[model samples]
Target: MEKNELKTTDSDNGHSPSETEKHLEHGVPVDAVNLPDPDEGLSEEERKRIDRALLWKLDLRLIPWLSLLYLMSFLDRTNIGNAKIDGLQEDLNMSNNQYNATLTIFFISYSVFEPLTQVLLKRFRPSVFLPVIMILWGICMTCMGLVHNFSGLMAARWFLGLTEAGLFPGVNYYLSCWYRRSEFGVRAAIFFSAAALAGSFGGLLAAAIVNMDGVGGKPGWAWIFILEGLATVVVATLSFWMARSCSTEKMDLQLTICQVHDFPDEAKFLSEDDRRRVIRRLKLDQQSSAEHEEFKLDYLWASLKDWKTYTGMMIYMGVDGALYAFSLFLPTIVQQMGYKSIHAQLLSVPPYAVAAVVTIFIGFVADRTRMRGYCNMVMSLFGIVGFAMLLGSGSPHVQYAGTFLGAMGIYPCIPNTISWTANNVEGVYKRGISLGFVIGWGNLNGIVSSNIYRAEDKPRYKPGHAVVLAYEAIFLLGGSVLQHVLLRRENAKRRNGERNNWVEGKTEAEIEKLGDKRPDFLYTL
Candidate 1:
């Protein structure tokens, strides 16, 4: 049993709550910092060694599988871009604008199902849930290969969107449960980097598949869909076996004590003396468990009611609108530069790759500095500059450079913003719902993104580029203002002797009984 948990409970006599409330009402300060460090008994070297081992466990257990799942999802959704250039349009005998309409259709389904999917992820274990979605989407993608016309294409895309709706937000909420807040950005980038890799891989794969044009009387574009879809199905099967949720849920799971030790060091900062005081305040024994097996189911509703929920949604929607637009259309944009299909696909690689690298670096820096809001603001500024340059420039080389900067600036900070929100909010239901709504709402921009590029704007795509640039600028301004406001509020609270507001709901006494949660649950700014 962990000492912190005991301090959080009502005193054995149950009268401690009233006494504590009275003291707080009188403005008598509680000595919150006088507690002893839980890890004070251990040497610094031992602590570092423990931290490293725990980090290794997290990487092995969670990061790779989560990243791979995200990679495939991104790949499956956008591979249509590759198929288009390989002759999907010609074979379907579709008009110039129909392909764009198909893209929009997917978002319609995607937006409708996203919030529901995120909420349901918790009901079933990841092993059962994620694999089911993967297999379904994979089969749909494969089925796309067999479609003879536009209707078939539209149907496949819609189902694909439906199955994929929950994946991003669900995984995000899942990751929050596993890693502490400080670790979120890097892990998220690691997961999202798969999108970059997928961009490169999708191009190479499309380039190779295009060579088989007219094989078996089917266009190479058809073969690409068939083969890629089959790959999705197979990969999804693997995910079923690999993906896991909580430690207690996996029957095959085997984690060593070294792995368990990676929990946040904030726990180590509490001592028996502090624990005793906490017990007196809220009142409980010193021995209790640090990591509990479950959390409240009602957290979901509580999370939805928070203003932070909508704020986070707006943040991601505005920033990610630009990110998704670029991701989905970059290959098409490159092809418009008059390069050969292969050249265009290959050219699309650098920008996404560069974005991935910056995202990873941003994660590490955010964790070390504990400054997510500032990092996000900086990333947005870069996006504005990059997009502005592209809108005005005509040179292929110069335009490509601008696109690269736009990609880099916007993507790196996005995961941090998401992780920031998840870390601040407690309770599994709230966390789950909050993550879902944030991601689901943000994804609605796909509706906007899909329509950004039109036949009327083709070749130069001046209108599409301009629209995204404006979107980026709006997001930048909004996020900057919101963060500033949040910071000022946080500062005011601290100055007014309201440190207890950092965690919200729980008074200092409740926190003592609940255990020093080590969430560092400060405001998002």
Candidate 2:
């Protein structure tokens, strides 16, 4: 009788128990047309299903590799700063001002190409496109070892920027495809900490390579370029085999690509019978790629119309200008502290090490506490004071201490700012375009940093210090204003119960179906 009853139940629902199990595991709506409200109280099976789905999303393999890619990308870009102490300028016959100009030139190319790459990612698979660019840049970095003149150094610098142009923007876009908006900030921090780690690692690596200065009749700077470049190439080649394309990307996918392959079979919490009923109710067609159908230029139009885009651009530019200034010139700054060249390179390690730990810790904490704006404001204030202490004091110990505090405190907030944009933007294309534009355009400050520290101000580059201080002050004030504007808009929206034009077409009844959705999508506060 029991066997007969089981058979009857199986026949009633089209999905087998295994298929239902799969659906629940993947967070596929068991009843596809309308997902049940989590607050309505779930059946034991349904609760188990949600738990499994969350667990699957937290897979460990994805995090480490993505973090490594970011690490190498950042390390390769800034290792040039470490190279300066080991005869880089002398070998290239670059004047002090010419050296800075080369740094400026990299940003010109970087800024111009980033937005173009975002458009291109829509057509090309990231697994292939990103790694190819990585390999190419790695090759360019290696060539820096061979450069013997100002023009050679200039050419290498431009190509370095051109090849690396899409890395951060592309990676940001790529991560968004995998993780939902709520999860992006912490992940973004993990990836961005690679920049901080690179600072420390580059210092250590340079210290070791400087020991090779007289061994191969090559200057220590040449070894720095050669070894780091080769490392980049090797890592890029490996990443080609390891990195995953987006879940929907078809044809030429990597073996290691992370994706939920069988939504129906994976959901275990919903009964097989219930799951089948749900599948029958959903709007999705198994054969269709939602990404292709949903792709639109609407986001580009909306973002352009929004004043926030320009405001975001200014904020990014100020933050990056401050960062790149320190990254490219810290060794020079330390040289003024009376350390030998190699010793200066080694000393760069401690500040960045502290910065890395502080950045990662604070990023996750702020994200957990949901305090993105406050965290950023605090970082800007710290930077302002750090710069002030160095500018006003003559004590080498105090200045060094100020530099470390500034580096540690200020660095964590920039990525949060980028992640803030990622979380708030709704459309993929707009996210891509905005990210590319902000990152690329912000690099313009590299030019300013390059020129600010002229040879004339060797011991104290008073102008350079003053320039950054001014930029930070403006950022502090502007950031406060922008936060206030966003808060006011959010409050007004809540009070008036008005949806913007973006959400205007959708009925409130329809939008309310997404229970956890933040309709206002307020900027991080």
TM-score, per-candidate, Cα-based:
0.80, 0.80
lDDT of 2 by residue, 108-175 (tens): 89889998897776556665787788889989999988888889888998999999998888877666
CA lDDT of each candidate?
0.68, 0.67
Show where candidate 2 strays beyond 4 Å.
1-59, 243-297, 500-522
Q: With candidate 2 superimposed using the best TM-score fit, by how many Å does residue 82's alpha carbon deviate from the native? A: 1.3
Give candidate 1 misplaced runs (Cα > 4 Å): 1-42, 242-300, 498-520
10 residues in a row with least lDDT, candidate 2: 1-10
Among these predicted structures, which one has the highest lDDT?
1
